[model samples]
Target chain A: MVYFDNAATSFPKPDGVYDSIMKAMKEYGANPGRSGHKLALRLGREIFETRELLAKLFNIKNPMNLIFTFNCTESLNIGIKGILNTGDHVITTSMEHNSVLRPLKVLEKEGIELTIVKGDYAGRINPKDIEKSIKKNTKLIVTTHISNLTGTIMPIEQIGRIARDNGIYYLVDAAQSAGVYHIDVEKLNIDMLAFPGHKGLLGPQGTGGLYIREGIEVKELNQGGTGSISHLLEQPDILPDRYESGTPNGPGIVGLGAGVKYILQEGLDTIRKYEEELTKHFIEEIVKIENVKVYGPLDIKEQGAVVSINIGDEDSSEISYILDENYDIEVRPGLHCVPMAHKTIETFSQGVVRFSFGPFNTHDEIELGIKAIKEISKEL
Target chain B: MVYFDNAATSFPKPDGVYDSIMKAMKEYGANPGRSGHKLALRLGREIFETRELLAKLFNIKNPMNLIFTFNCTESLNIGIKGILNTGDHVITTSMEHNSVLRPLKVLEKEGIELTIVKGDYAGRINPKDIEKSIKKNTKLIVTTHISNLTGTIMPIEQIGRIARDNGIYYLVDAAQSAGVYHIDVEKLNIDMLAFPGHKGLLGPQGTGGLYIREGIEVKELNQGGTGSISHLLEQPDILPDRYESGTPNGPGIVGLGAGVKYILQEGLDTIRKYEEELTKHFIEEIVKIENVKVYGPLDIKEQGAVVSINIGDEDSSEISYILDENYDIEVRPGLHCVPMAHKTIETFSQGVVRFSFGPFNTHDEIELGIKAIKEISKEL
Candidate 1:
């Protein structure tokens, strides 16, 4: 079966990832940082290696500042809620996933001021609009590096520059951009970055992380036994431990480290180029079909591997079902947990069938996808 | 290697658990409950099956009420912080782990009153003490089913009854008691049960759950995409969706299902009886050693598989190190993330070497642990 749901979760992760996870579980599956035994210490050391790999991937200087979370949603919650307090203003764009928008909406009810900069119909967010939305009370600016629904790569470099010049914290939701795109957190002037491991990173699920720049005091969302400062009832005042509470996914993080190692060895740019080729071929051919509407910038230069399309005003779920049942092509359909993004792209009612490509996706699969869309559109 | 660190996380989970996780990852590790494709639907169904299995194990009528979390600490944080608000009081016991205490302590600073009932030297909390601490403003009563540090089994049935009679929510931290002990939530009148999937449940480290009784309204700690009601900005007000956000640990939950399935097939009572035998043998022989001080209610009827001991006032970490390096017996040393429990057992200064047995542990391993303790005590 052809898998096109990389935006949701990457499937068939590299063989090394599976091997590393199995080895970690069978060999030293002990809880890391909780026990002091050899197995526990080994697992702890391996987990730190994962943090280091992620730090290198994101151009983070200190690995200790990076914290592993259950998923990107939890990371976004901690970064958004931990930084902004009551009466503090934050700026974000409409082309973000609910992971960013939902938390901001919740905080908005709790006395935090929020300004949502509107994105164009193609889900493109202008840094100038975001700068105009900023106010004196704006302490933070949040935006997704790439729109999950439209795959429109935002001008985060320009936005980051604006935030840095205005002395505001910039938090980037690199859900779609991480692993498949270049993200130098330091060079981008990003204060915080959240990314999921199971996405483009080719790691197992249950693994994600947040990178906090040095000296940023973000209150932890949940306080618990950090394994350090077990004597104190209060949470530890350490970097990762202050944020990470309880038993982490040990083998999962090992798998994530293996995934990063694979990416580094194979080269992130190489993977991105392959996926871009697939995306470009799929979009170029599919848009030529009759009565088909495609979303996003629809250009390899501005779009990631994700492409959203609707055939003849058909229900996105129905088209997705036909693709799954008739063509054996796996794709996600509907709002994609990004209602505002749907609104931005004018697919709030019709939704869109999202085909997200991974490194493993091939030109052959893209040809098949184009052919299936052409036939389905002609039949409609 | 003899793994006696089950309290931290169960190592070498039943073969089926590993197989199930591997199958889910390699075969159909699609994003569950996110997309409508066959792979996504299959994974979503598998995850729901896990929820059902855990519900059946816990005597929860509605599987929908069970919410999967990263770990028991996240579950406890959600249960404790979600239900209680400002001007509300919470009563907890000293035998509780920091997962329960730390969140309550944080809430205490937020104008929420916290009353920590002291446990006896054996780390046993009197039900009467918990009952007396309840005030008109008492909204919740939190307790651990079994002490992680001392293995003292508290009277949770009695405490649950007290909470029920007092019209307060009862939250049980079943980190130690979940898979082995019997927990009929309905019969015990438990309002909420938080448990670690990695501990006695024998799942991977990333999986844990909170079972909230029907009709109980608890505010979610974090909000994000629930995969249901994607059009609304407000978080979905559903049973599991309200609490579970973002892509879940699909393969991890599948592994947890395999674990609970193993428990069902093997019989929880039989597993508990085997662990009790191991505990009994280890305690009986180790207490006979000179200058060896054992903590907890030594009776298997009143304790769990965990036994904490100190050899001749020697530092617990030193003894633990010797046991690990010399004997290859893996155990947790230090406060065990339950500082108050250590203090209650009067081992606050000279911690304790904790040996927690799992279903897979054998009598031979228990004997080996006893021999190591005796040899260490004699040397001391």
Candidate 2:
């Protein structure tokens, strides 16, 4: 099947990912840091090395500042719940997926005030609107690097500057942009960045991380085992250990390292260029179809590889079902876990079918998917 | 390598588990719950079926109540943070792992009071101590089913009955006992249970879960992408989804299901009986050996398969190193991430070598391990 759910989880992980997981499973499956055996210690070193790699990739000065989490949602939650307090105002946009929106809403009930900046109908958030939404009580600004629903790349750099200038922390949800885009946290003034390793990084699901700037501390979201400070009565007031409680998903993290290595070797710019060319071809071809309305930035260079669309008189789910059963193409349906983003595009009621392209996807497959969508529209 | 760190994580999972993960990877690597397509839906159904199987194995009422997490730490955090609040009090024991103690300490700093009753030097907590510790304001009483370092099994039935009598919530950290012990949550008055699927469950490293009793609002631990209620401005106040955020580790969870099946087919009770008998024989033999001090309950029926000990005049790490480097016997040394328990046993500064056996371990292997330990003791 042609997999187009990279937004959910990229399939056919980078070649080395599964190999690394299997190798670890066989050779050093011992609990890292929990045991002192040679294999166990080796496992611990492998885990530490992966964290260091991730830190370097994200331009984080200290590797420990990166906390391994289950996925992007867990990473974002650690950041959202860690720093946001009751009565603290947060600036966000309609471009966010449920991960950010749900946590922010929960905080709202706990007395945290939230200011949601409205974005363009295609899910683009203006940096000026984000700056204008800031209140004196605002302590944080969270915006997606790219909207998952429409694939519109937000002006994260401009927003980051705004947040830093206001003495507020800036958090970029790099779930969509981490490996696909160049994110220099230090240069971007990005205080906290959360991302999923499974998507653009080409790692397996269940691997993700959060980058916490040196001076910022979020309330511990989950507390348990840090594999360090076994004698402490309280959670260690350290970097990753403070937020990461419990045994980490070590094998998955190793796969993440492999995925990152693949991306780094291939170069993000090259991958971005190929993905843009494919998406541009897709957009140009799909727009030729009658009564099909596409969402997001028309210029492929301006956005990520996500292509969302609604065909007149056809429900998104119905089309997705036909595209899957009749055609061997797999694309995600509904709001792609970002209903607010759908509302921004005025597609909340009907949702939008999403075709998220990855490096493994071929142009021929896109043609097949487009052909299937065309057939689906005709039936409707 | 002789891996005695099974309690931290059971290394070299049952061959069937490794095979199962590889099979899933090769057959249907599609992202589960991402699309309504057949492959995606089948994968999603596999995840739900795993939940049902887990509930059946544990005799739980609703499968949906079992929420997947990254590890036992995240699972315990969800159960703890979801159930308790400010001004509330919790009762636990001194033998508790850092997973419980650290979270409680953080909660205490947030104004939640707690009473940590002491465990007997053998790492046993009295049911009466738990009873006495409960206050009128107490809302939850959380304890471990089995100590990771001590191998001691608490009197869960008695404590569960006490919690039931007081109408207080009872949560069991079943990290080390889920498969090794046959526990009916309802019979144990267990209102909530948290555990890692990777350990006794024999799954991949990333799998874990938390089970909450029906009708309780488990304030979600993390927020993001629960697919449902995309239009809602708040977290979906529902079972499972309220706790499970982001995309799940499908391969890991599926592997967990496969692991549980491997146990269920063989029967957990039978496995428990075999492990108990082995533990009894090994403990009797080791206790007779000179210059060795054993930790945990003397009776195998009341403890677990792990045997923690130290040779006379030897630091635990030294013994562990010699065991691995010379004898090729794998074992864990240093504080076992539950230093609180070590303090109770008066081994706070001196960690013990921990040898934990899994079902796959044979009696001959135990005899060989015992012989190896005796030889190492001669050097000491």
For DockQ, the strongest prediction is 1
Tens digit per residue, CA lDDT, model 2, A134-225: 88899999999988888998898898888889999998999999988989998999999999978898887788999999878677777777
The count of residue-pair clashes in candidate 1 stands at 0
- Provide per-model DockQ scores: 0.89, 0.77
TM-score of the first chain in candidate 1 relative to the native first chain? 0.99
Candidate No. with top lDDT? 1
List the candidate 1 regions with Cα displacement exceeding 4 Å. none
Tens digits of lDDT, candidate 2, B1-380: 55556788887777777776766665666677667877678778889988998999888999988889889888888788788999999999898888888888888888999899999889999999999998999999999999887899999999999999998999999998998797898889999999898889988888899888888777777777777776786777787777777888887888889889989999998988988887888888888888999998878877898889988868998888888888787888888888889999988888888888888778887887888877777766
Residue A190 of model 1 has an lDDT of 95
Whole-model lDDT per candidate: 0.93, 0.85
User: Looking at model 2, what is the TM-score of chain A?
Assistant: 0.98
Supply every candidate's count of residue pairs whose N, Cα or C atoms clash at under 3 angstroms. Answer: 0, 5
How good is the docking of model 2, by CAPRI class?
medium
